[model samples]
Target: MAQFYSAKRRVTTRQIITVTVNDLDPFGQGVARHNGKALFIAGALPGEQAEVTVTEDKRNFAQAVVKRRLSDSSERVAPRCRHFGVCGGCQQQHASVELQQQAKSRALARMMGTRDAPREVDEIIADNPWGYRRRARLSLNFHLKSQTLQMGFRKASDKELVNIHQCPVLAPQLEALLEPLRQCLSELKAVRRLGHVELVLADSGPLMVLRHLSPLENGDRQKLEQFSQTTGVALFLAPDSETLEAPGNVAPWYHSDGLRLSFSPRDFIQVNDAVNQQMVARAIDWLDIQPTDRVLDLFCGMGNFTLPLAKRAASVVGVEGVAALVAKGEYNARHNSLKNVTFFHENLEEDVTRHPWAALGFDKILLDPARAGAPGVMQHVINLAPQRVVYVSCNPTTLARDSEALLSAGYQIRRLAMLDMFPHTGHLESMALFERI
Candidate 1:
């Protein structure tokens, strides 16, 4: 039997007790177990001693805030970003880049267990430590008393907005337009109706997408257009799903890898351009496609990887759930003059065995499924029996679950590497190569 503490009872009060951090949790918070109960201490690094004040006490674990750093880890460093704590965007900014990679790698290794894991872990794929984000979602809040437009990310664990003047993680061009955007929004009468603003950077320029709950008047539209023309930022309005319109001469712009990949503002694309390029290169390298090899890409979006794979393989088939994206993907393939690639629209959530494309044999397979993972597509991989499988994942838990399924299907994980795609934050991107046993 275990003893329990009551919520009304104060277990510890301002007790300046020194504790050593055991490790960091998924959220980059330091983890330490005290009296068989876990304590998640913020601003503390692993292998370091810190004085902490308990913020919230729970039956199983407690949460605390660090008061003083008695001893610091070698990996501890001053954060580079000004809005590091207030923005809640980057959690590992205080930790060294090398230590951050090590933490991510250790997390992946633990998730995949050591029973039959690979002996050699691939080198970490690094990206620009700052100003690499190509897309961002900025919240919009208007204060009735102050008559000011508060635009930025929400503070951690609160609805209060941070109101950032500049973001180091965003593209330089987009970051430079933050104050201009705030000024433009502040001048509009319909600014109160705008709830959020999303920025996506294409090769041509930055696109500013505004999410407004109410219809904009003519004057408000003119304000947006003037801002767009003055700052050279494209403006997009989103009052509803059916009401996605661009005002003025603003046209859709896209970022590509020498291959056309036009997408709507709502579509999902990798946020870090440099890291994505490296990740794509790594995925292609792991494929090791022979000139005669046929490749099949699952959950392919906008032919990001499909068109690239087509260049190396004899034929490539891409499957996606969104029909619009499939059409764009096919158009991209055609524009790139890659006749070897074909895009199909199918609901991968349902059974894909009956699909006509499933009958086609493939030599190599690549999967970049969403956070839910490819649970419905795993059995199909067994049925297709591709010689090699390359999987890129964003969720480690789901990746581990899917990896176990692949292992049961006689696929052995050969190599794996972590890409610090979202550096500063706890989000991790990983790539794994599995060979048919």
Candidate 2:
């Protein structure tokens, strides 16, 4: 028999080091240098000295958590939410809103200039820094130790939920329901069966969607209904992920560009209504739509932009990947009595020129692609050679990557604006204008 020697597992000790922060990155992490390697410290701002513990050790960069800040930046301000640092809902709450906007503006400029494109960020669109969030999702977990249901958002960098009693970022109406909602859930007989809760404020009022893994008892159902009736919140229950049941048969709707648009609870809508309205206005202004110009709107979600553009242009064609939104768009167009706009359901990831709608000449084009950006459609846009193009992007990195194709095709970036769609968060939304030279 051969004897093999097994070495004992070595325990790596965490290193605590003091570093001087140099700058803030786009993701709201403080950048520092240690031992010739880049160090990223969380909860630390620029122009601050912090003692940090390294959490991740990489070849070129290390990630650390701030143990304490020996010095603070003048831009630092007290966060409004008590759960600011722990909750994953926000990242820049410690920094002043002005500082956060400035950091974002600088980061946006750098991302756009990566391909040697224009470095100027033309405008920054912002609104009230607090109480602007019209939507939020709360996590639910049954704690065995305490024998209670925990309702809150997930902790930063952890799967555990933070018991949020008050969230300042939520709209005033939604935030007011936090305590009552938690109390009501605690009394439910099927509390353990609850998965999560989604709160959304439509133009009509605030609506609640309760997700449950199992069927609720009769008493529990009555309790939920009573809670809804008492609070005046439209309540819907989800027995499964895909199924939603509204006892009152309520239809949620919102207004945009003076048009009332009805949407399902799970449908996509902007969280910040004020900023969304402004964004739509700016996009139209940049496109410079004329009455005789035929416009093409890609990834047009439920005619959010298509209908608005239709009000100005001769003909507006809205293309969406989701068939449901296409139907909704058509319904909204009819609802708004705008016959000039047409909605089509098509997958934008493939060659779109084969579609009959693509064959039609469009003088101006606007696209609001998701985080993946418009990968397969950029070349087609270039091929069409529209007189003007407007791109609304949620991710700056992808926007920069996709802009290269447009720049190579003799489309000059005429304007760029940083949209503060989500305040106190690292989300960077932007709008750009490009004109054929």
Clashes of 2: 0
lDDT value for model 2: 0.92
Name the runs in model 2 displaced over 4 angstroms: 1-9, 115-118
What's each prediction's clash count?
0, 0
All candidates: CA RMSD in angstroms?
4.0, 2.6
lDDT of 1 by residue, 279-343 (tens): 88888888898899999999999888998889889999999999888988887787678999988
Q: Residue-wise lDDT of candidate 2 within 232-253, one digit each (tens)?
A: 8999999997899998789999
lDDT of 2 at 254: 96
**lDDT of model 2, residue 323:** 90
- Could you tell me how far off, in angstroms, the CA of residue 389 lies in candidate 2 after the best superposition? 0.8
Model 1 worst lDDT run, 10 consecutive residues: 248-257
